[model samples]
Target: MTLNNDYFKARLEELREELLAELAVAGPHPESGHGYSTHPADHGTDAFEQTAGIAVRRNAERLLYEVERALTRIEENRYGICRDCGQLIDRARLKVIPYARYCLDCANKHSKG
Candidate 1:
């Protein structure tokens, strides 16, 4: 089945915008150090929350990188094709993960390796 590049592009673009907005909102705002209480428990809680926030931000950054790469592939006319095997990616997979770069077989192989 043929995939609709325009649809995928639009979806990816929307995701990219959302991610950017999320990052902007999350960035430049380190509540951990701001108005932190002097209590021992408050310190511990703040530290844990800071760590969790860092983890979440890192994950968002990684996903943004992947999404940007997928957008580049789309621009280059290489989207929906497996990078390793050069085969068309499955339509169902694309529908689920519009930024996928590998077919199911290739993805499975890579995961195993």
Candidate 2:
């Protein structure tokens, strides 16, 4: 089956914009309050913020990597082919996850194994 470069290109651009927005939110900032004398509640909230920010940044970085890979695939003319099976990945799956490198069957098998 033929790969749809226009469709995947649009999807990749959307994902890139989303990751950039999330990364902007996750960027570091100075501490809100004075150091080492904050209340317990404030400290707890700070810890939660730090953890959440790290998680968001990590996910954003991963998404950015996937988006880059998708763009590379488009350049290589291999965008919708499953890497493992050399078959066309389903359009439905691509619509839902444009960065997917494997078709559903291979992905499911890989997950189980």
Candidate 3:
């Protein structure tokens, strides 16, 4: 069965908003030194937090990139097609990962090679 564009679009929009909110809360600017701490223990805690914040930002950015690509595919009438194999992606997989670019087989093969 074909996946619904409206459903995927709504899901992508929700994800985009969630990522934006996360980035906002995480202080979006790591190089500004906005949350420095002076105490030794506090410094360690601050360092850990900074590292975690950078990871969170990177994850959000990656997901945002995929979501944008999916949205573009929706607009271009190319949603649900595997980028590598030019085949229809499974509806179940799409439901689980709306921004997926490759089908399961191709994804596995590409990952292994």
What 10-residue stretch in candidate 3 is worst by lDDT? 35-44
Q: Which residue window of length 10 is worst by lDDT in model 1?
A: 35-44
Candidate 2 accuracy as TM-score: 0.79
How large is the C-alpha RMSD of every model relative to the true structure? 5.3, 5.8, 4.3
- Model 2 segments beyond 4 Å from truth? 1-3, 28-45
How many steric overlaps are in each model, in order?
0, 0, 0
Model 1: CA > 4 A from native: 1-3, 28-45
- Taking the tens digit of each residue's C-alpha lDDT, what string does model 3 give over 1-113? 44699889988899999999877766646656763443234344466787887888889989999999999999999999999999999989999999999999999999999
Question: Compared with the true structure, what per-residue lDDT tens digits does model 2 show for residues 1-113?
Answer: 44478878987998999898877656544143333243234344467676776777888889899899999999999998999999999998998899999999999999999
Task: Provide the TM-score for each candidate, comma-separated.
Answer: 0.78, 0.79, 0.85
Q: Which portions of model 3 miss their true places by more than 4 Å?
A: 35-45
Could you tell me how far off, in angstroms, the CA of residue 28 lies in candidate 1 after the best superposition?
Answer: 4.2
Indicate the residue-level lDDT of 4 in model 1: 86
Q: Tell me how far candidate 3 lies from the true structure as C-alpha RMSD in angstroms.
A: 4.3
Q: Of models 1 and 2, which has the larger lDDT?
A: 2
- Residue-level lDDT of model 1, residues 1-113, one tens digit each, is 44588888888999889888766645545454553343335344456776675676777788899889999998998899999999999989988988888999999999999
Residue 92 lDDT (model 1): 91
